[model samples]
Target: MSKTLTFRHVSYLWDEAKALELAGNEVDLFIYRSNLLGADLRLTNYAGGNTSVKIMETDPLTGQPVPVMWVKGSGGDIGTLTKAGCANLYVDRLHALKSRYRGLEFEDEMVELFNHCLFDPKCATPSIDTPLHGLLPYKHIDHLHPDALIAIAASKDGEAIMKEIWGNQMAWIPWQRPGFDLGLKLEQAVQENPNLRGIILGGHGLFTWGETSYESYINTLEVIEQASEYLEQRYGKKSPVFGGARLENTDEQTRKNRAADLMPTLRGLASSYRRMIGHYTDDARVLEYINSNDLDRLAPKGTSCPDHFLRTKIRPLVLDEPEKLAQKSADELKAYLTGKFEAYRADYAAYYERCKHDNSPAMRDPNPVVILWPTVGMFTFAKDKQTARVAAEFYTNAINVMKGAEAVSEYVGLPEQEAFDIEYWLLEEAKLQRMPKPKSLSGKIAYVTGGTGGIGKAICEALLQEGACIVAVDRNLLDETQTDLRKRYGKDNALSAAIDVTDVATINDSLRQATLQFGGVDIIVNCAGLSISKPLAETTQKDWDILQDVLVKGQFLVSQEAVVILRKQGLGGDIVNIASKNGLVAGPNNVAYGTAKAAQLHMSRLLAAELGPEKIRVNTVNPDAVLRGSKIWEGEWAAGRAKAYGISIEELPAHYAKRTLLNEEILAEDIAKAVRVFVDGSLSKSTGNVLNVDGGVAMAFVR
Candidate 1:
């Protein structure tokens, strides 16, 4: 095929040296090619495409050469594909199953039989698109979901456009739910046109094949590049994309502030059925679509590709004009959004009822996965941050598809019945059912003050392991700690902010950052504190003021700002104050520090009572002599306390431990475990209570 139009094209990334390095090994070359294609989002989305290579291997039982097909496994991303991540199957066995194919209605039954054809019984589970690769009569095959190709495939005149672009070099197939029957059709099409190098699945994706992996890789890129160039030429000629912008965007900061303010209420509404973590994006393309006149007309039609809508749901909930929405008070805006949510739920239920078959799974949560707010951005919610973020990305891909289609021809969405079939497909339902149960704090977002310090870092990690997204707040931002948390968990699951919690403005700003990063906060850990040990006669006014400022005032300010977001969510949250054992036990020369801890303890009880009606629980965890990892102990507090005890600084931990009933040294992790128990749904009903994690300090026990 030849192209007349000139535009920027996707770079051909196949390295001759790399290919030559794995010349004799087809599987390795296949993996290399798959990774290269998947490296570009324009070629495929994360885990959205599959690739396969057929190679001859010695049969383990027969000692004879047999053809085996290695394809991307189910739930595996092509970019990250590994040898273990590929499902290996017997090609002859796969082809033999065609005799058992009953028809289109029974094509799903073929998936179960694929297990019988596995070349390795221990191999990864094959994807639903396995037959799309296995049935094709080629050594290498690629099935990708590229926005440019999907644009043509989803256009009203998709077939005609294909004819104009490639004539008979590429074949066009109408929309069909992927299964054994679709694979049979692909085989038939290729057999009839021996010269065909690719096929476009209307309203879906693209398929291309070659005798070698490099040939297939080049063919896939060539097809997408030509389509993109053609679309660009047509796009440039169009006077305005998406019927031109209908609303002017406010300043970027104003949009972000408004988005932050709106997120908690939106998240609460989305979580009405089940809790959902959220992700927000104001990408240029997202803003362009949200501000366009075509948004109302295009957004409700939903997405065309199966991969796009599967993550983004069929249609998004688009809010009213930004100018008008900005005028409403917080309460008024929330009430209005509540009504919108109810209507959306009803509509989704009705759609399920209208299209469900006898074996259809129960209707899922009816909340919109994607929410569009003009002048602000897009908000996507799911059971976790990564899913929510991916949903937003898929919607952005859908927007690109729509823009391209509209530039050349009218954009078309999947037919309602077709969309419903894919959404509620039995196989899809089984996949959903097979997912592992959520962790303790799966969808919760937490704000941990002093998160870079010993106790604070432990709290962050513990919460993260339980699946909560963490916003690590501290007066001193520690890049190493934040990087480690992010790397250990996912980047989205951990964020760090520098703020003086004693300053209300900084406290508000930190909470706002938390809101924007992870929708909103459901748990607050007031672990930020300081200590000043001194006899009353020797203590200075500055020492007293600083202790109170950080230990008492800081907790109050952080809690106060965080409560604003919690109340907006209406999801009843947890507030765990890390008080000191000195608050309950009398200690010589520890007046200022002990007094501040006592104040923090009482504040938790008072807030617990005040916020009880809102379902926000407040509690305290007190730890004594956490000298091993404590920042407080790194200062004069340890030396002062040791001197008061008439012991060397090195002997402080042992001395404190010997005083406890259990005679155990308290660690920061021990304190973290106490905090976890309070918020991990184990003690949901207990609040305004204190837990002593001081290795059994009898005098420090809560009465």
Candidate 2:
């Protein structure tokens, strides 16, 4: 039977003009080509691929021309790679290291030698795959983990399929851990078949090369485009992908709500070893895979691509069916999930025991990084949001690979031992060990109401600096604040939303967005409020109602909604209310605002008492006169306070400072620091407590 083929082609994105512009510098042209390849995720995942170019550089010590290889540095993504992000090494030295190779058992020692070969001592560190490029005789090389090619490389008959697709033009190499040995294998393959254009590493990825950077880039794309076409043709022939749907997909909103409801529990479970931030996706492709009949069969078989499983784990923990999940009460659901989580941990432990070598690093977190719920979607947990999101993306890539492979032939996962060795590999462990210590609030998610306001923004920045993912909730979201936050902290680390804490619907929506954005909220900062300073006689019913609505009711509603998630997560959380010193001190022209502040103070106490059983701590930070950068002081409140104190508005800061024991002016950042003190694990044992950030206001001292 003639093999079916289709014409779904990947575009050749190389720009000859751009290439020509950078042609004078081989390294620049190589980086330019890498960026283009990485720009298309279909070609390779974020930071999953490596590219290289060989150039002759004058040696600084010898003052003689030497061949140097520039490849992507460790942990750098090609799409965003700069010249600084590339590792430059002496090509002759790299080849010389081959003489020291003591075979596969000693391949790992080669990585340490790479540092000695660096042309520049300050150059970015070399990656494990450096030998793969350096050992090759080709001028340019591209090693990518494209889904289409991997689909063929992962199939049971991948070698046969490779022959059918490229005939003798492409070669095949059985799975080998990326190292000097794999480099030698690649070198051997090319030497054996001088006419070959590329080689597919079985159950791993693709490697293509050329004499020039542009040719290498084009050849890589051509191979991927051909694989895509071949897969597309056969994919159509297979009726009902993934054996058709087993469960119907829930509507988008329903899926989101379900995910939100369950995320806290999932996150809590996944955080068994250490706290983990989460990312959820209900993308059409994810939903299709989750709802498929073959999900049970295919998902457990795990991912074939090393890059896919490195982030996603060997396999995912597939949750129960939608009907069963929907029917379970919160308690029942928790129990059911708890059981599943324990089983997954046990299985992971068993795998570790079965595969661990004497020198294997201690088994890391046994929690599942990726979890799939039948009707809802995929949930990925990691040390941070970016990793979680990338894990989901990798799994989605794996799903696509599985789909294509199943169409033409059976999908084959890396053998259990192979997957385990890669996961527990000494080199990977060293990389993990080299990572910087996580910030205090790492893996935490914080929701700050009135987030665009001066104090709120400061609080958000403080929390973000400590590594918390921020959902900046405000009554009116500012584009500038959003842009600044996203730019500085990254889109995944910071989010801005316009929400009214008084409106339950808006509060619900914001929390839902938070849950979907970063799993669930671990910190609730009720900073969204307004103040009305008026003497008792002048304070109208309208003034009282609005103050109560925004200052008291807003805190209550936002806290009330956020607690649902906190409880579901079963993890202790922090709720810091930005109360005022007026709550404790008797002050003139502060009837409405003081009354609302008093309510907020006591409400925090009440919540702390009520939520103590659930380990949720609620604390209050009372600021007496936070003048600079406070929106409250930017309006009528400042004038009212100044008049009440018989001073000019400009004199208020000094006046308030003089009244304090410390005689120090309180700023918005000072108030923000107080909030940080409450939630930043500094006062973990304290609850229902009021901490004054008023430069030592005597009357406001918590009794």
Candidate 3:
């Protein structure tokens, strides 16, 4: 069997690059080939693999030609990589850093070398394996720890078998923890045979190099194809079809909505002690692997590669007494999970003690990244979504590789000692230390009404920017707003609900939807209301009832219902209501609108007093002259305001802007910012107070 690279895409890039200068031209070819390889699960799983190309550029400082390696960066995934994704490192300086490696400690020196040395001073941190590419003499390199190749690399007689299969074409080197020393080992292996096209790391992955991107990429395929063929010919029939993308069959509880129903319960358990997010999937592949009869034995055999232990723990946790898990109550299941997690921690501690070497780093957060429930499915947890998804992909591939290995020969993983060394390696530990602290409301959720436009949309956007999940409430679902929001944050971050604030059933149902999607709502903003302008002489019972129905009665209905759930959740909550300055000051024609807003102002205070014991804080923001784009100011309302002020429609905005002490018109964003200040607890001790977001309007100021 033979494998081939898809060169059509990269060929087009090269044809266009003939006109480009050498310094920045290598990036297009590298990006095209990287994306091509990354799109195939066989070439790269999640963010596990890397690619690089070295080119010569003139140094502006000295007018001398310098070698620059445009290597994949630390946090960039190859699938979506761009020219900005590569870290430009000076190849000569990277090699020179080796001289400092003699006396410095392995872990500390490697971290510092990757951090400080760069050909482009402003480039992001380079991959920890940059030296492996920099010291190599080839112009192009592709390094992917593909599953089929790993299956052979991780076998007991992996080297001998690789030699038998390919003779001198593939050189097998024994496993060493990744660092400055591993780079030296790769360099030696390359020098061992200049004719060699690929180097197989004993417990690591494959490195294939060539003078052009296409040549290097094709070499990877050839090695993988041969390895896949070897396993099939040896024991293809006996293999249990591991490493598939989805499940062949599913139980009742593992199907459709039932699987999604389990996410809130599992996420609540996963984040109980620490605050990690959960991503659940009963994909055919994950379900197939966990539900197999042989999973009990294979689940504890260690991970596919050494670097994997850093994200996924050394192995996944198989639930204790799996037969009794699915039928239990949510509380009972959570308690059982807690007990099982404690046992896992104990086992992890024992493993660490047995494997620690001198200068080994302290243990990291011990929560299992992957958890398997016998009846339901699998769930992966991490602090964010991308890492959780990546962990799931690695485990999915692990299932296939291990099963494929067993079919050929017994599966052999990296020794526990090697796993421990890589897990606590200084280079891997520093990535965590370098991350910036999270935002104040990273895990909180905000439910906002009137979310499509005016002040509602602004509040929704503001909350998402602060790391909180947003549920945008309106009279109907806003698909455009949802699409735009999902594009910015993720699909999980923004949601929409349809409800007339006056309807309790619709309001309660939407609240239930928010709870189901994200665990619970932590903040509430009641901004749904319409403006009614009517003079005392012209006011009808109909106008009065409509204004009161929306501003006062409707506001009460929505807030009280949300507060009921907040009390049950027992988590402290914040409620910010959008009020109007007309509530405090009245004009000749403001009979209906002013009175309804005044009732809302008092209702906020009453709720604050009643719910204070439950730790639910309530406040109000009075926005004046936010008429630039508000629906409230559209037809009859704008005409009425103009009639009261005795001005034409064109002069209405200027009149309001000069009415303020600061003489500036207040925008919807200004009101949104004021609402955000309240929710983030900047005014934690000052609830039941009104914030004047009218650019210093003297008439709206409260004493």
Winner of 2 and 3 under TM-score = 2
In order, the Cα lDDT scores of the candidates are 0.91, 0.89, 0.76
What TM-score quantifies how close candidate 1 is to the native fold? 0.98
Worst 10 residues of 3 by lDDT: 7-16
Q: Rank the candidates by lDDT, best first.
A: 1, 2, 3
Worst 10 residues of 2 by lDDT: 1-10
Could you tell me the TM-score of candidate 3? 0.81
Encode model 1's per-residue lDDT on 1-703: one tens digit a residue. Answer: 3422332667577789989999999999999999998898888888898999999999999999999999999899998898999999999999999999999878788999999999999999998899988999889999999999999999999999999999999899999999988888899999999899899999999999888888888788888888998998897476589999998888889988988998999999999988899999999999999999999999989999999989988799999977788698877888899999999999999999999999888898999999999989999999999999889889999999999999989899988899999999989888888899999999999899999999999999999999999999997756888899989998879999988987988888888888888899999999998888899999999999998999898888888889989988999999999998988988899888899999999999999999999999999999888988889899688889888989999998889889989999999999999999999999999999999998887788677
Q: Which candidate wins on lDDT? A: 1
Q: Enumerate residue pairs that collide in model 1.
A: none
Taking all chains together, each candidate's TM-score versus the true structure is: 0.98, 0.97, 0.81
Candidate 1 displacement at residue 559 in angstroms: 0.8
Off by over 4 Å in 1: 1-12, 16-21
